[model samples]
Target: MCEDEKSLLEKAKNGDVFAYESLIEGYQKKVFNLALRMVGNREDASELAQEVFIRVYKSLKGFKEQSQFSTWIYKITTNVCLDELRKRKNRNITSLDEEIKLEDSEIKRQIEDDKPTPEMIVEKNELKKVVSDAIKLLSDEHRTVIVMRDIQGFSYEEIARIINCPEGTVKSRLNRARLALKEILKGKAELLSYEFVK
Candidate 1:
């Protein structure tokens, strides 16, 4: 963390609400996106993101800075998301068809084709939906590794820290997650039609 961030963390830990908000502004979108991927819904992700920040604030004083602040925040994020998933599992409620809203810039980043043709736009949207659905079908462990390493772009070391596992285990789990995702995508005729699965 930079000196500026350390100052902000100190202020935030001292009960400065504005400082706390400022400290979290840079991380809000990322936390929300991670939660969205894990829970597969905007409403739930939004709630979970709020919960994460609250937990962070409550626990801020005890933060030992042994890990990067980002890593600590993400560890909280993944835990909150996984806890919600466990609760939802018992209830057995999931919605696969709810459209996931991503900014145009984010869409362009994730999709290789930069051309803005109407056909390409529609294809990109469909592809995103297909991939999101497949990801939702993964087991929690597989999905966590996939989202952290691939979509969220966290390094294996960072992911291992967030998930509290060995770095090699992170790599192995990611490999298995990719294969599981491919298998899930293969079962989707829509994805196959899009040439997303070989």
Candidate 2:
């Protein structure tokens, strides 16, 4: 965290609502993106993001400076996501795999290529959907690892801290998750046309 954020955190801890909001302003998109990927739906992601901030606000007073404030917030985010996943599992309502669908804008946001031919754009969209769907098919552990490391671009150490695991465990899980995703993507010829799989 930057000095400004650190200062805001301190003020927030002291019950400054504006300070609290300011502290979270920079992280809202990241939190929501993580939630959206974790739960596979916009509505649920919105709800999760709101809940995360609420939890952060309530827990701000207890935050020790041991880890980056971002890490602490992510820990809370992952816990809430996992808890919600468990609830969904217990209810046996639906599989998470079937619930997640990435919007075109979200997919496009992840890719930075300039304008392409219409045909190429369509192909890219298909590829993105295939990739997103394959990620959803992964187990929660694998999905979480992929989302944090690959999509969110967190380092191994940060991921380990967020998930409360050793760095070795983080690496191993990420390797397994990558393999699982590769296996799924191999079945998709559209993705194969791109250089990412190779």
Tell me, by lDDT, which candidate is best.
Answer: 1
lDDT of candidate 1 at residue 22, scale 0 to 100: 93
RMSD of each: 8.6, 7.8
How would you encode candidate 2's per-residue C-alpha lDDT over 69-166 as one tens digit per residue?
89999999999998898898789854323433332111111222243443553576766766776676666788899999999999999999999999
Q: How far is 38's C-alpha from truth in model 1 (Å)? A: 0.4
- Per-residue lDDT tens digits for candidate 1, residues 85-111, read 889766766432232223210111122
CA lDDT scores, all candidates in order: 0.81, 0.79
- Where does model 1 exceed 4 Å of error? 94-122, 190-198
- lDDT, candidate 1, equals 0.81
The positional error of residue 3 in candidate 1, measured at the CA in angstroms, is 1.5
Determine which window of 10 residues in candidate 2 has minimal summed lDDT.
103-112
- Could you tell me the lDDT of residue 115 within candidate 1? 31
In model 2, the runs with Cα more than 4 Å from the true position are: 95-122, 188-198
